[model samples]
Target: MAFKLIFAALAAVSLAASSGAYQLPRSDQLQPLNPPIDNLIPLSAYIDGLLTNAERMKRGMGPARPSKFSDGSVTRREPSSTPTSPSNPEPTDVPTTTPGSGVIRIHDPSSSSTTLYWVSKDLNNFGEYGRTDDISKALTVTLGSDSGRFSIRTPSPACGCVSDLPFLGGIMGYATSGGDLKSSSADYAYLGATVETANGSPAVSGDNSFTRATGISKSIESSIWSISSDNSLTATWINADGAMVDAHILYYAADNVLSLTADPVSFVNNFGASPAVVSSWLSDSTLAVKATAAI
Candidate 1:
């Protein structure tokens, strides 16, 4: 019995020595021991071995077990807080058509309103017609009639223009260009009208001739003239007499009556002298008109 006890004690000692050099302390407060070697295993390895041994002891090795693995793709992950550089930055929304390039009219018969499009082109030009009292957005064509008229009245850019007519208002007629005037074109201003016949028609100097014959220095500075569908010539002018004139010269094709208004009322330099009171004078106002008639 004494020999048996000695043999059992030796076996226990051998098993303990083979298992590990020292027992790992249960308390987490203890600082784990590390081996002083070039290639040293971390404290976590010892803990992992301990856990494996404990698990093996609980469930004895029976058969080969399949290893478990987590899929990186299937794992639910959070978006990175750090911004990543994009290969191609997202493109911004761009408009298909440019503003002021051309007119885009929308007529709503249900609402009985026609929406006109007139974007700002030149520096002095505005986006909408008739924004100024002298100008009109009357460019709508009559249905079944190949005739339309639009007038643009604007100040000469930078107080300087080809006419050298001070910073006065000048006009552009869409009808003069046969409704083909492009706002995008650089030659859409008075400066573009270099000669009398540069646009489509020459300004009628018949009135100027009449005034000159009467010993008057009355002449049209920048004028846009168009013939109406009924063969009537409509002329809008910036006259040298410092007045804006809209003349309707009618000559009936049937009767051959060359009619002109006698004693045509003239507006003062700024239309604020006889008819308009000087109290409500528009100091820096001038009138310029250009009409493009269907005829």
Candidate 2:
């Protein structure tokens, strides 16, 4: 009888141990989910990682994007860097695309830093200095009905890019480049536009533009000045119809200064349409659209 009782007690303990809380597991704190941003990551990737790790250790995580990434469970992606760096000058030993080639590498104009390829070769950025927008994400510039694309890595670079810093609200600032324009470019400075979630309200949305160049950046600046607008800053550039003009802006950032520039637009003339004209192109007889910035 004693042996029988002891055996029953032991069996009960064994069952409990096999199905204890530790065994069941804690589903609430699931492991972090990581998505591949392709091999050879960029500063943006690293910045993304740091923010994610920091956020993951917290409670009540939110979405990544309103379109897709937002609803999925929150998980941190690794920053494509050494996990840390000082301001822009500190080089984060990361991978990069060759210059004038592709973006295994890119230059951060704001600080002349670098990292791997986040650049979009939408048009013909050629990944050179002063060839594309400095503030916006790699532009999706296009040319020819065939739908080709290219990228501009930096207005200027110092090898690697400044480490990505998500907490800073997308590197708040206006980005001006010493960049030039290319033929395989877009009518607008940039496209495939995306709005900032934080900057939401009944007001003006952020906008960037490109035009066919009629004059030099220095000359255009002289003719272009702001008159007035409800918005904080207004910049204007001068160019002729069928010329390439480069102008870009990124609003709702953490900074005040606006980076601005103008370069001539280009045309492969896919249809060979009478030597490519601006969206608002005019005949010589008609007024060349009065050059004025409204208040």
lDDT of each: 0.25, 0.24
lDDT of 2 by residue, 213-251 (tens): 110111112112222222121223333332323344321
RMSD of each: 44.3, 25.9
Once model 1 is optimally superposed onto the true structure by TM-score, how far is the C-alpha of residue 220 displaced, in angstroms? Answer: 2.6
Please, what are the lDDT tens digits per residue for candidate 1 over residues 1-295? 9999999999987888888954544343322111123432222211222224443332221222233446523332333568566596432221112222111122212244343322111222211111111112211111111143223223222112222121111223221221112222211112121112222232322121112111222222233434354333243443334344443222211211111211122211111121210001011111111122322
Model 2: lDDT of residue 101: 24
Error of 2 at 169 (Å): 16
What's each prediction's TM-score? Answer: 0.15, 0.19
Evaluated against the true structure, the overall lDDT of model 2 is 0.24
